[model samples]
Structure formats: C-alpha cells, structure tokens
Target: MLAAIVGRPNVGKSTLFNRLTGTRQAIVDDESGVTRDRVYGEAEWEGRTIPLVDTGGYVPRSDDPFERAIREQAETALADADVILFVVDVTTGLTDVDQEIAQVLRTADAPVMVLANKADNQEREWAASEFYQLGLGEVYPVSGTTKRGVDEMMSALVEALPEETDEETPDRTRISLVGKPNAGKSSLVNATLGFDRAIVTETPGTTRDAVHSVVRYEDQELLLIDTAGMRKTSKTEGVEYYASVRSEQTIRDGDVCILVLDATEEIHKQDLSVLTTVNEHKKGMVIAVNKWDLVPKDGGTMDQFTKYLRQYLGTLDHVPLVYTSAVTKQRVYDLLDTALEVAEKRAQRVQTSDLNDVVQAALRKKHPPSMSSGAFVKIKYATQVRTAPPVFVFFANHPEGVRDSYKRYLEGEIREAFGYDGVPLTLVFKEK
Candidate 1:
C-alpha cells in the first residue's frame, strides 16, 4: 500500500506527489536534495488509498558516497513500495540518469508508472512521447500544477495494486503538535527542553524534518514528535502539498496528538484539516491554543473559541484543550503536566476486580438501562485489556444490548475511581 515517487531533481516529482496526495508534507525547492530524506503521506487513487513516499530527488551518482547513500534510501523506498511513479520533466529531454532509473525500475518487482509532468499543453504532451523509449510503457503526460490527465494516471495506478490488504503497523503512542506556519512549535519545544535544543527560527519551515525528542514526565519517558506546519490539502498546490502528508507521519506515529493552534488568527479550514488528520489516526489528542498573549481581553473569546472547537470537532468532545503563549512561557509548564496526565491515563490498566467493583457500585445506584432489544446487558466484570490509550473489555450477558450512554456512564465511574485526568479510555463490550 505504498508508492514511491522517484526521479532526478527538479522534475516536479515532489510537485506531482503533492498534487496527488493533496498535502504540503515535502519541502520543495529548485535546489537538489532540498528534501534530504524520506517523506511519507497517504495517497488516494481512484478510491483506493496507499502511502506515497516523496524521496530525496536522486542525482546520477555512481561514485559519490553521499549520493550512494541517498540512492540506497530511494532503492529501499522502491523495495517497500507497492508501485513506483517514475517522474520525468517533459521540459528537459531524458538523460542517461533517467535511463539508469529506467534500468533500475525494469529490475524492480514492483510495477512502474511513467509520469511525464510539466506537459501543460498539447505540444508538451507531444514532446512527452519520447519517454516511451524507456520501455516502462505508456507514459502518461500530465501537469502537476494544472492537474491535467491526473485522473487517468491515478486510475491506471490504482488498478495496479497487488491486493486490498491492511499491513500490520508498529504500536507506539504518537502525540503531534500541529498548527499553521510560524505557530511557535519550535518555541514550545525549547520551553519543554528548558534550553535551546531545537533550532528556533523567525522564518517559517525552519524545522523541515519531523524532530522527535524524548522527555520524562511523572517517571515515564514519552516521545514527543514536533511536526512541520500543515496547510489545507486542497490549497496545497504542487510540492507544498507534500508538507501535509509529511506532517501526517507524526500523527500516524503517535498514540495521542496535541494540536497547537495559533491564538492570533481566526481558526481557518486548514487548522480543522490538521485536526481531521489526528482524528483519522484515531489517537488520543489534546489541543494547545498557542500564543495566547496576542488575543485581546475580550469578555468571552475563550468560551466562544472553545464552543467553536467542540462544535466543529464533534464526537471529539472528550479531547482536552489548553491555552498558552510559548514566547512569554505562559502556561508552558502546564502543557507538559497535562500531556503526562493524558499519557498516564492512556496507559491506565484497570483490574477486573476493580472494574467490577466500580461498575456494580454504579449499577446499584442506577440500574443498567434497558435497550431496544428488550434485554439489559448484565455486566459480570470489566478489565483493562490494554494500555497506552487504555482499552477496556466488559464481559456481560446480552452485550449487544449495551448502549453508548451507559458505556459513557461506566467510563465516567472508572475515571472517578482512578482520576485519569488527561488520558482517553476505550470501552469494549463482549459476551461472557
């Protein structure tokens, strides 16, 4: 379920990738190796989804050791990919290096799709015809900027997947701090590090790569991945599109995400899109409204903002929210405290005996509600099945009769018993 976009530098490989994935996850520049490492993003082609890797644009290097290492990384991407997108600039005719890539693709077990980008018009499209000589077959001349012939290209690519299968992913608690460009992500990291560890910059996109710093809070060391700024997928427009995809890797890697919103700007569609990525990851999350000092002393702006968040984010009502200014170090310490609290809660393990005690006690006070099936779920016992975003399983007769409201009640009771202030809990129903 992965496709690696490979080509020589400045061929618009990143641009084509960004256009397809609809994210600004990869840093694009006229300079080579601007994308120094592997960048990944979710790619949807013709309703079938897969991860798209924007590798560092390769240069024809059979000799340089550094170039060799980059080539190895690109080869690894090829090995891992379900399909390969070989992008070539229609503006520049194919070179020996392009043929070298073709030879590599011919040797690869994965299917290769030739994309002739920058073919903005029919004349350029005609110019793309020469790429057929590479022998990959059927060069699809398209424009990443204008998006011409993109649909056909995507359809052709989707049909080439081996099978519809979900791969087993690594289990890790991921917490992402996402916001618009220059939204104090680096400053917050500095405040948390208590030094100038993370390089702070006045210009945006300084932290190009996703930097992970492990910190201990309440005796537990947790990985905090500081991701780059994410813009709306629709407005991504070419290579900037890869940034959203690259930033999403942090979200996918985390068990929980802490969205850092700029308090100064009116919450735009882009911020919501970032949150949407967090939700799609299904990780426990908290929102840190950053740069709070800039906000005027309005009577109820905080309340209004909170209301808007809850209303828009819906069903994520349980997610926690905190406001702070990284520059002034206002409430910065509280952010870590809350993060630890949430992490511990996520890692909570409730014993079956303890769960039964709480559930039965609550049930005695208020009987398990009747359901539409005309049978009430008789809970015998409940226990924490897992930790790190704790998941609980309840053994019961007529488990199907259990309703969401009653489940919430049981969750509330458990929280009251354990005082999991910052963690999210998962409840499951099972027949005894």
Candidate 2:
C-alpha cells in the first residue's frame, strides 16, 4: 500500500513524517515552502507494511512561481496514493486553503484519511473534532511529539487495507553509499572496503556514474555501489543531470542505501530531500554522519542529530543511524559491519515450521481480538514467503481484523527468535 501525507504549508507534516519514518529525510523549519520536491519512504504500519510519501507543502495562497509546481506535485502524490493521509493543524482550526484541500480530496476517488496534527493536549484533541465537517469520516488526532493516536490511526489503516501477499525469493543484498556533492560518500565507500580502491578526490562530485565493486567479508559478497554526488536540481544540466539521474537510479536498485551526511554544515533541504527519495524507494536505509572529525565536539551532537532526524523524517522508524568520520577512518568499518548486518537481516528467510511455531507461541501468549461480527481471528499458519527485506506471509481466518498492533507483536517475536538487525521486516496477512 502507498500512503501519501499531504496538507497545506507548515502544518508539521515533515515533523510527523520524521516521527513515522525515524529519519531526517525532509527538512523541517519555521519557514514554509522549504520542501520544494516530493520525498518518499517505505513505512510499515505494525507489520502490514506499505510505502509512504512526503510531498512539498501545499502553499495555496503563494504567488511564488514555484507555488504552482508544488501544487502539481501534491496532486501527483494524491493521484498515486492507495490512501491519502490529509494532515491539518488542530490548534489553528480549518483555514480556507484547508477547506480547498478537503474539497479536492472529497472529489478524489482515493481512500482519504484526515489527520488532526499537533494535538498535544486534551484541548487540542477536542479542537480536532471541527475537521469532521470536511466529510472524510472520523478525524484522527495525532501529536508528533507524544506519538499519541499514531498507532491507533495505523491500526485502523491496516484493517481497511485489502489483502496482499509476497512471493518467495533468494538473498541478494546490494548496499549503495550515496549522498550530495562533497558529503564524503566515496570516502565512506573506501573506508568500508578498507582500501584506496575508490579514488578519493578533493573536488566535489568527483565520482560520476555508478562505480560498483564486490567486497568479500565473512564469506558474504557485498556489492558496494559508490555513486556520484547529486547536485541541486536547478544546477542539474547536461551531463550533471545525467549523473544525478544515474545516482538516483542506482539508489533505487540497491537493497540498502547509506546516506552520508556532512557534519560541518547544517543538514540542508537537499540532503533531506534525497533521504525522502530513498525511503520512498522502499530500500532499507542507514544515515551515516560522515566527516565527524570536523564537528566541534561540543557534545550533544549525536543526540541533536538524532533529534533533528526524527523531527524531519516523520513516520519512518525502521532505519539505523551511525556516526563516522570517513576521512579519519574512525568507525568507518563499524558502519560496514552494521551495513552487512542489515543486509543479512534483509536477506533472511525463516522455515515454515519455525514461523508456524512462532505464531502458535504468540497466540498462546496473547490472543488476538474478536471482530465486530464476533468472529475470533485465528492465524492458522505462517511462513517466510520472501527473503529480500524478509517478507513473511500469514495465513489467517480474519486477515483484515488481524490488527496492525498484533502483527507488530508477531514481527517482534520473529526478530527475537531470529535476529534481523539493520533490516526491515514485511508481514502480509492473507487467507489460505
């Protein structure tokens, strides 16, 4: 399922997005219209997973030349969504632009869910009720700070989803190190390989096209893709555009994407935008704070980095974060270790007997809820249907009512039984 989070400018959409994705994919600021492009992520609602999209904020009243382009982008996201999460500021009530957006969603033939955001308190939660007049069914009040109502909203979302299943697959893990110009992507790549195989240049965007090399570690061959630095879209012209396009294409092709960030400069909108693209591609991701040696060592940098990451890249929480100084080779190999661990987890496959046994044990520990029609939900069998990113299919009596929360419990059990570190798990509920 593909869910697009859309709303007017500065309604905390990016903040909520970071909370959900556990990433800093989108840049968050007091300024509106900062996010000029669409950002994407793969989000799992419990174990009923799906892709998520964070589009440029819709500034309905702006006269800026780019305003029209942003509107069109938002419209495109709406068109592509299996479901639309319409976010709104509960404290501010409904503005005319909000009404305009609601009207558009009303005409849209897609599944639309209204989210009353920033409802951090009881009063704000009550304030969210006014949005019901938009006619998008019940409004879900969520506080990105507290994470309140997020799980409930996700639970309802998973229940409303149609049945889907995954097929079996072999393990082929490819991890790509990617980032903007001069962000040290190549340095990180070389550090991972522990050799100077990848040429490191002082010039920005030195590495062009996709340079791929296979490195053997612990009996596993890791295909390391060192990509060119992606320039600003406006600066992307001729061969530069070709390089940027190829870099993005390479990111989508990889099983895991490691976004190398510069520690000296403040994280830019461009970096966050690239991250959004990675998440949208549904690739397991890790954010490496590259060039850590340059940081002032004022302390709290790691916490600050994580806080900002969570703030901007909402709703994507499955990614791993690492801090490394690629130039100093400090903790660089650790990043590779983490990447390999993630790759292994992503490529894992569990036996049918093991899966069934897990489900049986889970049910015995905590029973699933009864449906509204009074039928008890029963997971008859479960098995690993796929390996890449480790997708498991559950054969159940009440697939719809299995509940996202319960599915999360099952995934947790599977992880505990078989450690799938650094990888995202996908769970699909289907009838036998």
Candidate 3:
C-alpha cells in the first residue's frame, strides 16, 4: 500500500515521515520548502511494511516556478496513493493555508486522515480538536519529534489499508544514472527508454528526486534510477543539499551506476567525487561521455579524450566508457549494454582452485616486501569470501607483514587471470 504525506510548508510532514519510516531518509529542517520532491520510504507497522511518499509543501496559488513544480509532484502522489496523511500544526491553530489544503483532500478518492502534529502538551492536544472543523476525518493528535500518538495513527492506518496480496516482485538490475548538474543524465534516460521518463530542462538541478523507471531490454529487466546532479556540499544549500543526500542513498541501493559526463566540458572535481563515491561503495560503474554529437571530433579525438580521462581516473581506469548522444540516440543502447555487463561482472564468482593458482603465481613472481621488524610473510592459501563486489580472503603466516604494494600486485594478478572489470575487489588478509 502507498501512503502520501501532504500539507503546507513546515507542517512537520518530513518529521512524521522519518518517524514512521524509522529512517532519517527525509531531511528535516526549520526552513520551509526544504523538501521539493517526493521522497520514498517504507514504514513497518504490525509486521506490515507500507510504502510512504513524503512530498514537498503544497502551495495552491503560488506564482513561483519551483512552488508550481512542487504542487504538481504532490498532485501526482495524491493521485496514486491509497491513503493521504494531511499534516497540520497544532501549536499554531488552523490557518488559511491549512484550510485550502483541507479543501483539496476532502475531494481526494483515498481516505484522508488529519495528523495534528506538535501536540506535545495537553494544551496543544486540545488545540488539535479545532482541526475537526475541516471535516476531513478523524484528527489524531501526534508529535512527530517525540513520536507520541504515532502508534495509534499507524494502527488505524494499517487497518484502513486494503487486504494484502501475494504478488511476486520481478528481479531487476538497478542502474543509477548519476553526474554533475546538466551533464545529460536525464536526457540519457529519456533516450534509452525512447520516452521522457524524467523531466529534462536546460536548467541545472531540474531533477531534484531520484526517479525510477522499469524497462525490459532483451531478456533482462532493468530499473533505471535518474538522480539529481551532485554538487559540492560547501556550495549547496536547502533543497539541493538534501537532493545530494538522496543521490548518495541511491548509489548505495543501486547495482550499477552510470557516471554521465558532458563531452563538451572538461571533467570537473565534482565528477571525480561522484566516481569516488561509487567506488567507495564497491558498486559496479560505467563512465558515459554524453553529448558526443556536439563535440568536434577528429581521427584521434576519442583516443586523446580517453587518455585524458584515464589520467584523472588513475586506479579506476578499468571502468568501461561509452560515448553517447541522447539527441541523436548515438550509442545510447550501447551504454545500457555496458552497464549490464558490469552488473554481471560484479556478480561473478571465482573457483577456489582458480583463485589460489593466480595468488601462487603472483607470490612466486614477486615476494611480499619484508617488514621493518624483518618478520617473514608467507601466504598459505586464498579463497573468495563473497561476490557482487568480489571479496577474497588470503591466509598468511604474518598477515600484518603484507605490504600495500604487494597487495596491489596480487590484485593485478587476480584481475589478469579472472576479469572483474568495472567492479571493485576487496582483499582481506588474515593470520593463519
């Protein structure tokens, strides 16, 4: 079941969302309009998990472009939700904005339940009774900060939801398209899906949410997540700051990430930051040089650009790169194919015998450097401990004596023998 939390700005909708979902996924702030997009999370109550959407502040008669966009997002959530959580502030009595929002919820098809938030004291809880004049439904006095009265609200909410059904969720390879602002991440998504799956604008940070779309390519089902452009935290504020946080969460949830770069502009530090984030999470990645149609190219342009990127992507040179043009649909499908290949490589498992053979050969080629204490280091055997970001554990007589340089040598030999392209490898050394 899907439930949407909607109300005017700073009515504690995000606070309530975080409280129920048991996660700090939605950013809470004193500033109004902090949440400009629909943030999705799951709420577990009475052994049942209900999907929740926290929307931006709903402004009825706003002329601001952002406010209008926020209203549209809220309306979309309202249209699809099974239940509506209309939040109101009890500390401050009924207001004109609250009245306007209540009017709209009365006409909604879903059951509307008013949440009188900030009712920490008996006085404030008494003030919550005034909201009944809106005539939406039962007014539950709750405090999102203290989580008081939330259980009663959720218990009622779960009973109000439709009966559960046993439906199977399809297995999908989640591919996250992430990059700096206006790097053509959304355009790539629209092109790959052959439709406007995401709102594309010339303006930077147009997509403030991690929008998800499912598509079937060949025999594989893929979940494409188009995320907001990541900017340096020092320069970001308010909504954009939270947008960056959402993008980081998307990276952790994704199976493979496609780092989109504008071919016309030189790679920036922000782009490298995104790359490092994906690497640090140990997620499979593919580098996409977008807007190839706009770039002036010669016989060696691609080769020179590849070399330039390699310099910046020192250790990440193994990641696959595909030059694409969303406008002309040039190599757009190829990018998807490369991402799928990276996903497969991430899930690849190696046999114990094959793994040990490579480790033995690497040790014979170059012995591990000795420690300052001159303790002898002898590696006994190696085994893969995990897949989907393959991790190998090596047993050694003195694991602490293995040098970083020798570790790199062993990693190189393993990669040479068994390809793990576009996937991070974790090597653990243990004393036998």
Candidate 4:
C-alpha cells in the first residue's frame, strides 16, 4: 500500500519520511521547497511493508513556478496513494496553510490522518490541540526528529492500511534496468514492451521516475522497471536527486538488475557507482551493453569489451553480460531469459552436508593465512546459513586471522562445487 506525505513546506515531512523508511532517500534540509519531487520508500511496521511517498510541499493557489510544479507532483503522488499522512508543525501552531491542506484532502478518496510534528515534549504535544480545527480526524502528536510517538503513528498507519497477502508467484522476476542517463534504458524497456511504454528521447533525464510494466512473455512473468538516467550527485538537482534515490530503491526492490551500459561510451565512474549500488544490494545482476548496433564490431570486439568490464568489475566478473540493441531488437528478448536465469541462481540452495564437504576439500587444498602474531585461522565447520546471495558462515578458532584472500579462495571453491554462477556469495567468519 502507498501512503503520501502531504503538508505545507518545512513541516518536517522529509524527516518523518527518513524515520519511517530508515533511509535518507528524501533530501531533508532547513530550506523550504528543497524536495521538489515525490520520493517513494518502503516503511516496514509490524511485519507489513508499506510504501511511503514523500511528496513536495503543498502550496494552494501558488504563483511561483517551483511551488506550482511541487503541487503538481504532489497531486500525482496522491493519485497513487491509498492513504494521506497530513503533516503539520506543532511548534508553529495551526496556520492557514494547514487549513488549505485539510480542505484539499477532505474530498480525497483516501483517508487523511493529521500528524502534529515537533511534539517532542508534553508541552508541544499539548500545543498540538489547535490542529483539531482542521477537523479531518483525530490528531496524532509525534516528533519527526526524535522519533517520539513514531511507533504509535506507524501502528495507526498499519491499521489504516489494507491487509495484504502473498499473491506473487515465487518465479516472477523483477528486472530493474539501470545505468547513466542516455544509456538507452528507457528505449530498451520500450522495445522490450513492444510499445512506447516509456518516453524515449535523445534528451538526458527524459524519464523523471521509475516506470513499472508487467509483461508475461513465453511463461516468463517479469516486472520491467525503467528509471531516469542518474547523474553524479554534484550534477543532480532536486528532481534528479529524487530520481537517483528512487533508482537505488528500485535496485533494492528488484530481483535481478539488468544494468544497461552505453556501448559507444567508455565505462565511466558513474557507471561504476551504479555497479557498487547493485553489488551492495546483493541483487542478481545481468549487464547489457546497449546500442551495440552503433558500436563497430570485429570478431574480438565483444571479447575486448567483456575483458574491460571484467577488469573494472573485479570480483563480480561472473555476472552475465549480453550485447543488446533496443532499436535493432538484437538480443533484447534474451534479457528476460538472462534475468530469469540469474533469479534462478539466487534461489538455488545447497545442503549442509555437500557444503561442508566442499569446505573440507578447499581447506585441505589451501590452509588459511597465518597471521604474524602466530595465530592461525582454523576452521571447525561450515554451513549454508542463508540463500539469496547465499551466505556461508565459517566458525573458526580465530576468526580475526581469516584473511580476505582465503575467504575469496573458499568462495571460489564453493562456487566451483555448487555452481552458483551469476550470484554473489557472502562469506562470514565467526569464532567458534
């Protein structure tokens, strides 16, 4: 379920958003109108994942261009939300803007809950009584800064949200197409969808938000997410910054991220930054060098391109790579197949017995690195502790002496034995 955070500017809505989502996705600042776009985040409260949208400040009858844009964006977010979390500043007391917001949400299909923010103390909480004049419903006093009363607020929100059930198939693959702007991510998605689902143009940053499309092609059910081209932090402004954060959120939400790299351009720092996000998220990945039709190719061109990518990707070299052209429709359909392939690998599991056997063989082949202090890492046993970027915990005599090199070697051996290709492995060293 989606909930839109609506209020006048500078009322700590973004602060509340950060508290709820446990992420700094929305740019919080003292300056009013800093958040020019609606930023969506996941808020997990009482085992339920609620999608929260931090909307731009609502200014009624605003003549300013930015304020008008903010209001438009907030309305767009409101249409998608099931609930509206109307925020107000208790310290500043009730104001005309508060009344304007209340009046606007009165006819909304979703219910509005008044949040009297800055109620960090009993005095402020008491001061929030005037908010009753809005007459939407009962006002809940909470501190967005201290997070005081946030649990109660979230609990109230949970009650307001509709109950959810597990309806998604386990095999449904969510593919997030991501990369720098103008890398043809939107074009690729449009081509894959066989229609102009996403707006494609030569202009950078044409896509302002993540466009989601559900398609079933030959038994493969896929959620294709096409997001705006993300520039460097220094280059990003209000809307673009929100887009970048949403891109990261999209990465986390996806099962397998198909990174679309520009074949004509050299691999850039921003491209690597995206790779870092994909790596950090531990999502299964497939790299697609888009616009391959534009690249002059020889027999060894693909090999050289892959070699360069491997040099940069280093440990993540095993991720599947495909040369694709959205315009030519060359290898575009294969993206879904590769994404499903990666998703399958992410769900693959190994038995404790087989994993321990592989561990024993690896340890016998190469002993753990010896520390200069004479302490050596001695493995007692190994187990497959988790899946989804399969984590293996190795209990040892001295976990501190387990060097990174040995961990990589053990991971390689485990991969060789189990064939967990196209999936990142997590190695954990713990003292027995």
Listed in order, each prediction's TM-score against the native is: 0.59, 0.53, 0.66, 0.82
Q: Which rank order by lDDT, best down to worst?
A: 3, 4, 2, 1
* Shift of residue 214 alpha carbon in model 3, Å: 0.8
Which regions of candidate 3 are displaced past 4 Å?
1-168
lDDT of each: 0.75, 0.77, 0.85, 0.83
Error of 3 at 388 (Å): 1.3
Question: Which window of 10 residues has the lowest lDDT sum in candidate 4?
Answer: 66-75
TM-score comparison, 1 vs 4, better candidate: 4
In candidate 1 the C-alpha lDDT for residue 190 amounts to 78
Task: Indicate which candidate wins on lDDT.
Answer: 3
Which candidate leads in TM-score?
A: 4
lDDT of 2 at 199: 77
Question: 1-432 in candidate 1: lDDT tens per residue?
Answer: 678788877888777778888987677678875664446777776677777877656444447554454445445556556898998988998877688778777878889999999999999999999999999988999998899989899888888878776888434344567777788888888787778767788887676557778766556666777777776544342233445555776677676678888888777777776666666555666788998998986899889888987787765566678889888899887877776667657676777787788888988987887768677768888878787657788888878888888888887888778865445667899999
User: lDDT per residue, candidate 3, 1-432, as tens digits?
Assistant: 678788788989999999998899788898887775546778999989897878757433446664444445445556657899989999778987777667666678889899999998888889999999999879999999998899999999998888898898778999999999899999999998899989999999999889999999989899999999998765554467557757876888899999999999988988988899899889998999999999988899999999999888988888889999999999999999999988988998899998888888888888887777887799999999899889999999899988887887787788768877788889999989
Cα-lDDT of candidate 2 = 0.77
Candidate 4 regions with alpha-carbon error over 4 angstroms: 4-10, 13-44, 51-66, 95-108, 168-171, 193-197, 208-219, 231-246, 369-374, 400-409
Backbone clash count for every predicted candidate, in the order shown: 19, 19, 0, 0
Model 3 residue 32 lDDT? 85
Query: Per-residue alpha-carbon lDDT of model 2 for 303-332, expressed as tens digits?
Result: 987888767665444467788997788988
